[model samples]
Target: MIRGMRGAITIEKDEPQIIWDETVKLVQAIVAENNVQPDDIASIIISTTPDITSAFPARSVRMLEGWEYVPVMCMHEMNVADALPLCVRVMIHVETTLSQRDITHVYLNDAVKLRPDLITKNV
Candidate 1:
């Protein structure tokens, strides 16, 4: 079955290095939590808030070992009046045996406010 894992993270600043670091951290957590390899990922779609224009989050994912082969796209999030800032969100589609409910969705840092129910404190 094709399953998707969702994750979001908030960065401290709009700097390229910070965005890169946070993106790497978020993707790594999503991959580990889902127990899926990069090859298992069919595609990954990443979006950043309007304020985050310093870098494309997908670039960080491509930097990961073995992730270069994965198809990934980056986009800008729709601007909302009260939306979170410096937030990067990703949806990774993968071929997996896990059900939708069983998939772990991660929200880190200030982005945790975006999904209170799915946020895992320990992660």
Candidate 2:
């Protein structure tokens, strides 16, 4: 079955290196928590808040040792007036046996605020 795993992370600044680092960290954490392999991933959709324009987060994932062929896309998150800033969010669609409720979602740093209720039970 195809399941979508969600994760997000907040960065202190919009520097390219920092975006790459945090994006990689967030993706890795989510993949590990859900026991997902590169081959299981069908696609990755990544989005950054409007304030972050330094780099494409998908580059970091594509550069992973075994992720060269993983389909990935990058874009800016919906620019809501009061939404969190400098945050990167990802949705990873993967082939998994786990049910939706069994899949763990990862939220790091300030991004944890995005899903407080879910985090308490799922993170």
Candidate 3:
């Protein structure tokens, strides 16, 4: 079976390193939570807010994890008024045997506030 897990996190600063570091943290948490092994990750799609154009957060994440073969993509988030800025959102398609209810999702930084109920349940 395959499962889709979703995660979103916000960077406190617009700087490249800060955003990259936080992105790494978020991905690590998400993968661990969902019990996704390196070979289990089918692909990852990441998007960042328009305000963040310095670098693809996914690049930093892949480098940190040393995952060279995982398919990764980074794009600009849909520009909208009042949307979260400096945010990195990810949707992971993973090959797993776990049921959907067992899947874990992650939200970090200000994103934790976006869905406090969910984060509280996981944390």
RMSD of 1: 0.8
Q: List the residue pairs that clash in candidate 3.
A: none
lDDT per residue as tens, model 2, 31-78: 999899999999999999999998999999999999999999999988
Give the candidates in order of lDDT, highest first. 2, 1, 3
Tens digits of lDDT, candidate 3, 37-91: 7788889899998998777788876785557788888988889999877899988
Q: Which of candidates 1 and 2 reaches a greater lDDT?
A: 2
Please, what is the TM-score per model? 0.97, 0.96, 0.90
What does the lDDT read for residue 16 in candidate 3? 84
Choose the strongest candidate by lDDT.
Answer: 2
The runs of at least 3 residues in candidate 1 whose Cα sits more than 4 Å from the true structure, single-residue gaps closed, are none
lDDT of each: 0.92, 0.93, 0.82
Q: Which stretches of candidate 2 lie over 4 Å from their true place?
A: 121-123
Output the TM-score of candidate 1: 0.97
Q: Lowest lDDT 10-mer window, candidate 3?
A: 114-123
In candidate 3, stretches whose alpha carbon ends up further than 4 angstroms from where it belongs are 120-123
User: Would you list the clashing residue pairs of candidate 1?
Assistant: none
